[model samples]
Target: MRVHSLFLYPVKSLAGVEVSVIDLDDFGPVGDRRWMLVNDQGEFVTQRKLPALARIGTGIDERGVSVHIPGEGRFHLAPGHEELSVLVWRDWMNSLIGPKQASAAVSRFCERSLRFVYMPDDTFRRVDPARVVDQKRVGFADGFPFLFANQASLDELNSRLKHPVNMRHFRPNIVISGAEPWSEDHWQYLTIGQARFKAVKPCSRCVITTMDPDTGTKDPGTEPLRTLSTYRKTQDGVIFGQNAVHQDGDHLSVGDAVIICPQES
Candidate 1:
């Protein structure tokens, strides 16, 4: 399938930036969710708790990353700001305490005792339960920074809906067109340009997916998600998009041909 659009979330829970091309590293895309806001306990924060974060805008220029709010002024962040140390997620207390902390700009924006930091792509961090330590460095993501979705799937959902929905509701890092609806659901691995990604799991749906990205209103009286709940419900929850764990790769651009290889039975 052909790529329709590309996006990056420089910081988690905030509005993302649209780009034509992005450099795909081991963790995901460069500058994508490389920074995040966390409370004093070091747990990552997001729009799920702070919906206002959805109003924040992030941009990348030659200088570096810049954050902008509707009424709040702009703040710039230095590159590799969170590379000083490592941050770990503690399961005993369900909090994030770390040797690394959030940047001052991030602290001011969130207006809490939270710190923001970046995790270099070369660093290794452990995620609980899975015991699958991710060597591909992640920025300020809950787990992975990039979430890829298929445009055809969205179209299929919209076709069954009374009112149309924009892709913004899905908040994906990459939206590829030309594939059959929900084709990504069965894809075992996808190779776009030099980037290689393994479809690890089905991403569960949250209120965030039901929220109106433009008006900031919550509405789930729609199809697909509701229809999906009928059968796609996993032990964890209802599934929507496919989550991917990727290895390092070169830059991926629009119009780049995506190679899809389904898993063997």
Candidate 2:
């Protein structure tokens, strides 16, 4: 198997950019989900409540990051010196608040009050201790440094759906091809290019998967999820992809061979 695609989400919950090559830092992919949106309560907001977020595009350059929302025009966010505490899941993380202009743009796009924030070098949010013992840290991602998905698993899910959802629905960081459907479930460790990653947990499916990443519209029947409930249902939720943590090495590129490390008997 080989790396089929690479993705980077400069801001959390926005449309992701597919890249040919990416550097894997201790925080997962460089510039991946380092920025995010939050409400007045300081809690993070995502596509789960606002599907329109899927239409918001993000790009980063030497200056800083830019957010583009149709009609609302483009707004740029530079790293600020001010730090604010924001909530993601149950953790309260310190983040560099984006400039007022960027916050206003995001609020208008979401049609609600919101603030833009970025994780700085000082803010080290540890991975849930129960999930992995490595004490690794992630950016604004849900819980892990990386998310890996097999194309064959999506192929199998598409075979069961009427509309046939694509890989974008899951928004994984690393995508692999040429593996049996759901074969990642058995993988304990994998090597892609020079990077070694340990599969930490099976990513749980949610309503976000039912929404169209391109159009920001959701399926009325909540497809994929509805169908997944029948078979992919677990005690926690419906499982789709695998969450991984970087263990060693660096850099990933498309077409790099993926070697599944053998498990000890």
Candidate 3:
């Protein structure tokens, strides 16, 4: 199989930036999910709470990361040094409260009070040790460093649904082509381009997937999720993709070869 596409989410929950190349730093993908939106209570919020977040697009350039509000305007995201304790899922860690203008501008669009937070390199959030033995770190992403999905797997799902959905629905970091449907389930280790990764676990499907990545609205029929639940449901929840940790690699490019290697049992 080969890499079909790649995506980088400069800010968590915001529309991701599709790039042909990704540089891996200490984190899985450079410039991915370093920024996030938090509620007034110092808790992180996402499309699950306010689907309009999906409408907020993200972009990264020499100037840094910027958020784009459709039909409104774009603003540069600048997080300051003021540290704030925020909760992402069950893990609470330190974060930076960015500029007030960013909070106000986005609040006006989402119509709710929110704060922009940045996870600096100093703020370390450990991945679930039960799934990954190594104490790997994660940013604002849900729980893992990288998420991989097979294109054939998506095609298999689309065939069962009334309306087809794109890869954005599941928000995978790496999309593999030429793989059999559901082949990722058996992938214990992978070498994509220069990077090596270990499949931590199957990513659970959620309501966020039911929300359209563009319009920030739910599917009237609750399709993909509705269809997925019927057959893909598992003890972990409805499964769609695999969450992986960066084992080794400096960079990843589109069309890179995906090698499934035997695990070191």
Candidate 4:
């Protein structure tokens, strides 16, 4: 099988940026989920609560991120912002607070008091101890560094749904084509391009999947999740894709061949 696409969400919970090639570091993909939106209490805000975040656009360059909201103006987060402690999930993480103007602009769009923060190099946001095999760390992502989805699997889910949902609803970092439906469920190890990875766990489905990536509008029916639960329900939750961690190497590109190894018998 070959990699069909690569995506990076520089800021967690926003629409991701598709790229032809990605340079992986200790943090999986460079600039992936390194920034996040937080509320006054420093609690992380996401599309799960504020679907409007989906409309926020981010462009990353060597300097930093350029953020834009339609008809609302733009803001930027460059180096040398103030440091602040923000709460993500259960962890309190140290992050660089975006400028007040930028924060206010986003706050207006979100219709809440929000601040944008950037993950710094010194911070080590450890992955969940129970599921992680190695001493892996993530940025603002929910758990692992990478999330993988198979096209065939999505095809199967789409066949089940009355209105097919696109891949964007799932927000996988790596999209693999040419794999059998749900084949990733049996994969223990994989090598994509020069990078190696361990399939750590299955990603659970959530309400965020029901939100339209472009408009930030939610599907009243709570589809994909509602349908998946009937068949894909596990003790963990309704599941879809696999969460993974980078074992070694750097670059991954679209069309790179994928070599998989099933779990040992």
Give the top-scoring candidate (TM-score).
3
What are the root-mean-square deviations of the candidates from the true structure over C-alphas?
4.5, 1.5, 1.2, 1.6
Residues 1-265 of candidate 2 have per-residue lDDT tens digits of: 9999999999999999998998878788999999999998889999999999999988777776788987778888877888889999999989988889878877987789999899998899999899888779999999888999999999999999899989999999999999999898888889888788888899998889999998889999998899988998877679988999988777999999999997521
TM-score of each: 0.79, 0.96, 0.97, 0.96
Among all windows of 10 consecutive residues in model 4, the one with the lowest summed lDDT is 72-81
The regions of model 4 sitting more than 4 angstroms off are 79-81, 263-265
Give lDDT tens digits, candidate 1, residues 38-68: 6655566777766667777788999777777
Instruction: Check candidate 1 and list the clashing pairs.
Output: 34-139, 42-96, 82-118, 102-115, 102-116, 103-116
- In terms of lDDT, which candidate is strongest? 3
> What's the ranking of the predictions by lDDT, best on top?
3, 2, 4, 1
Candidate 3 local distance difference test against the native:
0.90
Badly placed stretches (over 4 Å) of model 3 are none
Per-structure clash totals for the candidates: 6, 0, 0, 0
Per-residue lDDT over 96-194 for candidate 4, one digit per residue giving the tens place of the 0 to 100 score: 887778788887877789988888999999988899857899999998899999999999999999999999999999999999999988888999988
Please report how far candidate 4 places residue 177 from its true position, in Å. Answer: 0.3
- The TM-score of predicted model 2 comes to 0.96
Tell how far residue 14 is off in model 1, in angstroms.
0.4
